[model samples]
Target: MRQGKVAEPVGAMVIPAQRGGVLFAVGGLNGELYVNGQALTGQWAEELRKHVPELSSDLDRLQAMRAEWLDSPPQDRTLALAGACTDRNCHTTH
Candidate 1:
């Protein structure tokens, strides 16, 4: 995986659903978060949290919902880590 470089993703998990929107977590290389090559700094998580907060006042219920989502089936999937892909467009996957 590119040695100790953190900018490149060492691994990735893709969960595809035919009837759902997209939610992605992009980890920066060298601690710099970017989207379409634009740096987001500390605003990404904060912005997302504000838009999609806990689903309920009960933490347990929220946890259950998260578990359910995680357990759901995926349409097409890919599990990748460092050096897993050798492509010019390795920066992203559709």
Candidate 2:
């Protein structure tokens, strides 16, 4: 209930490869964001959003990638979509 504290485990999806440690939590207050116990400012979230849009379209792509990871072994194809995102202006065709 305190400010900047995440009290509950909402939902989490693990990214693959270099980003495998990322976590996502919905239904919680817009409190401080953290990955592996390090605190992050809201700006960090905003920056990530800019690179990876949270829109349903983008998420659908990620979901598909996750599904593909289940049977076939992970490949460069799975990482092509998001792994290439480096600049702040990187945008995926939706």
Candidate 3:
């Protein structure tokens, strides 16, 4: 495996809106979304959805939104989160 690449088929939950949005990683005391206590991002979550028909409808709707966002490139500089995010004077250690 290379640093910029991932070996596919990483197992994950393809949770839908029907389950009230992925009950397992619904956050805790610190308000961080995690799966089995590990931070799993959307790039990784896509691995879970690629093989399932579960989120197809969402994919359709989101694709349309993606197209619209692409049309307005400048205004859509960053992906928006549905949670609270405050800009602090501190640095984020990524």
Candidate 4:
């Protein structure tokens, strides 16, 4: 584990089944949320929220969107995330 980081195994939870076919797991590291090894934004909007409730509604929404994009061809995934970031003003540098 990384310094000042916490990891929670989401393996027991079935992501795809619960979130419209998006497979992912939640992990907390350095007060951050990671889903299936990738850092999550909408799911981890706040650091404090990480220790509290499950944020199921937001998670479901993000997961559904992710599933929709993942269902697209590999080359399209980048485009999808990029578009989302732009729309959300995330300003991700990629």
Candidate 5:
């Protein structure tokens, strides 16, 4: 949850992280994206855009999703993802 690391209900999510992979930039969730700890500066961001051409559009979508998630009232599950399990692998009781 902090610094791109999910430290709860441990599983595969932590393995790559433990090995120094950038799982995700937490700031991206807030619209200000980053890679590792540094901001995705203009030059570097362009370099990344070459490989991920839709990055800009995806960020736009992310903002919209955020608005819905934060501004809307409670909603039902899109899929039966909730279940009583400590970890994801065992969370199949939909």
Candidate 6:
């Protein structure tokens, strides 16, 4: 009999939010938030509202905050995202 490769359990799931506008990391020991390839918000901050229809106030707030932050034109949005990932205590190796 042939044996199939055992599937490893996933520590987290990356969910698409807002038609792939953002990605959320859930089901891990620590929750994290990312946007446009950048980690700009935290999970505890309720940034997942962007995906929820009923509780969207937090999403609106995030948009407004992002707008203001972009007004200055971040020197490097990619770096910012990387920094956020690190700030959120996400392991890059995974």
lDDT of each: 0.30, 0.35, 0.32, 0.37, 0.32, 0.35
Report clash pairs, candidate 6: none
lDDT digits (tens) for residues 1-94 of candidate 4: 1123225432112233221333233323233334544555554434323432344444555456545543442333333333332123233323
Task: List pairs with backbone clashes in candidate 4.
Answer: 5-30
Which TM-score value belongs to model 5?
0.29
| Alpha-carbon RMSD to native, per candidate | 12.8, 12.9, 13.0, 12.3, 9.9, 13.5
- What's the lDDT for residue 35 in model 3? 34
Evaluation by lDDT, superior candidate among 2 and 4: 4
Clashing pairs in 5: none
Q: Which prediction has more favorable lDDT, 4 or 6?
A: 4
For candidate 3, write residues 1-94 as lDDT tens digits. 0112222212222233442333122222232233323433555346435543454444443334334434552221222212112223211222
Q: How many Å off is the CA of 33 in candidate 1?
A: 5.0
lDDT of 6 by residue, 1-94 (tens): 1112213211322323334333332211122222323334455235445444442443444444455454553543333333333224233224
* TM-score to true structure, per model: 0.27, 0.29, 0.30, 0.31, 0.29, 0.28
* Candidate 2 colliding pairs, count: 0
Shift of residue 84 alpha carbon in model 6, Å: 1.7
In model 4, the Cα lDDT at residue 85 comes to 26
Global local distance difference test of model 1? 0.30
**Worst 10 contiguous positions by lDDT, candidate 6:** 1-10
Worst ten-residue run, lDDT, model 1? 54-63
